[model samples]
Target: MSRRRVGLTGNEAVALAWKQIRPHVVAAYPITPATQIVERFSEYVAQGEVDTEFVAAESEHSALSACVGAAAAGARVLTATASQGLALMHEVLYIASGLRLPIVMNVANRALSAPINIHGDHSDTMGSRDAGWVQIYARSVQDAYDRTLLAVWVAERARLPVMVCLDGFTLTHSLEPLEVYPDEAVQTFLGEAPTDGYTLLGGEPITVGPLALPDSYMEFRRALAAAMERVPQVLEEGVRAFRAHFGQDLPSLVDARGTEDAEVALVVLGSYADAVEQAALRARVRGQRAGFVRVVTFRPFPTTPLREALGGVREVVVLERADTLSGLGGPLGVEVRAALYDLEVRPRFTDVIFGLGGRELRDEELDNLLRAGPPGGVVYLGVEGSRVLELA
Candidate 1:
């Protein structure tokens, strides 16, 4: 489990990890940032290194639908896509979770299109937030690989699909040296998927995907909710197991720096956290007592942990890369605010939206944004017709 560096782009790292996991089926269609994932998996299949069925699905919807079939047939299944591709599969996404299928997917976070730009943004995943899947964000190429492996363990254990998210172009195309783990270690950690006569070939003839009446429908949805509620606990256990095998524990809710006594805090998700951390470091050196909280687990939304982390701060800035345009609120910002609503001593909260359509954000820009915002206010970063100085 000792660390050794080997350079790789985030997509390459995920592909390598998928190979190690040895899923029974892979159904994918090409999309930027995510295309490399399926391409590398296809190569593995061609080389006979992987024993899985690689289905070149016609569309994103088909890819997920295929995964649904494979998973229901009691096969370990995987798929990868982004943006519109993810959007197309939106319906099946809910089905994957509601049916309690243990399919694992890699979502290369990207902006959805009318003008059609393919770059890193949370729009794709954020749009599908209610699909009843557990989502985990990756900050680096190494994280991409490690999380993909963990996603399988979490999904199968909980019998719910899991989305392993990576910032498009940031980690997807960015190269970094990563330590590749041995296959045997991975197998030991993930263990064998449970089998109970759910297999397609099993003679017991079990039924799946049947219509549910109003009485049973609510109960099924409740079951899905209960499974999601169990994710945080299972995630903690998964991290412990991963640490035992890989020697590096992944943070579940918040990754913190200088938060113990900080008066001002920046809360963000995904690769943006790297910039926020740098800004926080500079602020700390200047005796500003600033820190950051990175949301690694998005779907069961980590409300309790976030509230505890930001509760003592005098000022809290919620930075989001995705916009909830219909509601005119940043998705992460709105969620963070909701989490703090019941606290007696809530921090001064601000919403700062930046880095949309893959807009680049520098550390200095983050520092300035933090400085410009007032306590208990929402500030739009990098917006036209706004008084805030444009840092780009």
Candidate 2:
């Protein structure tokens, strides 16, 4: 249970935690921000520090394909990617989850390109929102490291793949202090590598990824959907077991701060959480009752806490780094609104899409927003065409 402070970037933290867990296979390719994770892990493989099968895949698609294959063969598998790299792996992402492979992937969240710029954003992960993976975001380097370990525990238990995501350059490259668990404690937390007779490595022969004809295709899809419904429960059990071993509890999937008695709440996610939380505190200094809600587990959507976080607030300001152009608001905003759609006593919602493609948010942006009170609909931050686009 001894913990010591160590300095590490998000990518290094993921690589370090993953190395400790020692997955059976790692399928990797070099992608910005995310590359450091696989590259650092590769050093361990070369140095004989880890007994992992390192697959130097040709492309992101090949990387995930290799993970699917390894995991299908009952290997604890892992991989890392971001941005278009994730886009390239899009097809196989579904297959990994469809076949019920418990592969743990680290996505250094980045902006998907048409303009060909590479930096941090949630566009990559947001695009795959329905890819049937349990997506969880980390707010800092320590969270990135801890969450990476937790993802493995959760994925193996649920037999569902998990994506531990971090902001591309912001967190991925920024070094910070974090406490790492001792190796023995980590093993105790994870328990034995799970093998519940649903793999190719088992004695009984089994086939995976068979093409389902029309009669069974719908049923297969339903099974996957139903499996996702079990994620919240799996997450609950996983966190409980983790807390019992570590003596420190992981916060629930969604975290609420200053919300117990507040008229305004800010809903946000990812690496910018600290800033948003500070914005909430600053609001309090000005005699405004402000609070903030952060999404930790993005998939299965954490509906319960999200609804409770905004329960009695009179207005909500949702700050998202990624925007959904086709929708009424940003991705997180749309989801937050959907979570409380049927509830009668819900706060008014405002969606603000900011900091896309590593865009620099103005120094006073958060302070100004807190001072101005919650606006209505989609507000694009720091753009030249500056105008509030009303929700459609």
Candidate 3:
């Protein structure tokens, strides 16, 4: 039950977790922000620290395709990517998830390029939301490590692929104090490399990812949906096991802070939630009753918990780092509003889009925005001129 406190970047911490699990195979291509994860783990492979088959594929698409093959053949698999790398793997993402391969991936969330920015945003992962993989966002280095381990167990139990996303440059590269658990603790919690159900090797002949025409296609999809419905239950079981083994709590889905008695709540995801929490405290000092909720698990959308967290609040502002360009608002804004739709007395909700392509929002600006309460319409924080978007 011993833990070590050390300084490591989010990428390093995640790699350490992979090292502890020592999966049967890891297939990845180097990409910005996320490159270091595979880069560092490659070192582990060279040193023979773990008996893993490290495959350095030529491209992201090839990397993921390799992972799908390995996972289908009953080998525990993992991979890493960001931005366009993830976009390139678009087709395979569905293949991996659709086949219910328990292939875990670490995504360094980055803004997709047009101007070729190599910084943090939710665009990369959010774009793949409908691909059917379970998505978990990490807010800190320790979160990146702990959740990566949790994702492995969750993926195997659910027989679905999982993505552990950390903000690209922000968390992936930033050094922070992290508490790392012993290898035995992680191994015991995750169990051996799940050889029973995942076996595609030396087993009865089976068709993997077989063609399903109209009539049968919908049924297969419905089964996938059923698996998604069971994620919350599986996630809770993993959280409880993690807490019992490591003596640390991993709050499932969303993490709520100071929302019980507050009148204003700021909802956000990833490392930026810390900024909102700080602003909330500052607003509270001015007697504004502000609080912040960080959405840790994005996929399968934590509707019930989110509704309960903001149940008492009068105003809720959803701050999304990506534009999502839905012609409506950001993805998170739409989800939040819909989740609270059934409430008897709904809070005044506003969507504030910010930090696209890695734009930074100053602390004073964030505090001022929170203190001022929900704006009249869609506000684009930190963009030049015209903060609110008035759709004609």
RMSD per prediction, one decimal? 1.6, 2.4, 2.3
Prediction-by-prediction clash tally? 2, 0, 0
Give the best candidate by lDDT: 3
For candidate 3, which ten residues in a row score worst on lDDT?
Answer: 383-392
Q: Residue by residue across 1-392, what tens digits does model 3's lDDT show?
A: 78999999999999999999889999999999999999999999999999899999999999999999999999889999999999999999999989988999999999997989999999999999999999999989999999999999999999899999999889999999999899988889988766665356845776788789997999999999999989999999999999999988988899998999988898999989888889888888988888889998988899989999999889999998877676768899989999999999999988888888888867777776765556745778877764532221
Residue 120 lDDT (model 3): 94
Per-residue lDDT value at 209 in model 3: 83
Query: lDDT at 258 for candidate 3?
Result: 92
Candidate 3: C-alpha RMSD to true structure equals 2.3
Clash pairs (backbone) in predicted model 3: none
lDDT of 3 at 324: 62
TM-score per candidate, in order? 0.97, 0.96, 0.97
Q: How many clashing pairs does model 1 include?
A: 2
True-vs-predicted CA distance for residue 131, candidate 3, Å: 0.7
Better of 1 and 3 by lDDT: 3
RMSD of 2: 2.4
lDDT (10s digit) by residue, model 2, range 98-157:
998899999999998888878888999998889999999999998888888889999988
Name the 10 consecutive residues with the lowest summed lDDT in model 2. 383-392
Clashing residue pairs, candidate 2? none
Ten contiguous residues minimizing lDDT sum, candidate 1 = 370-379
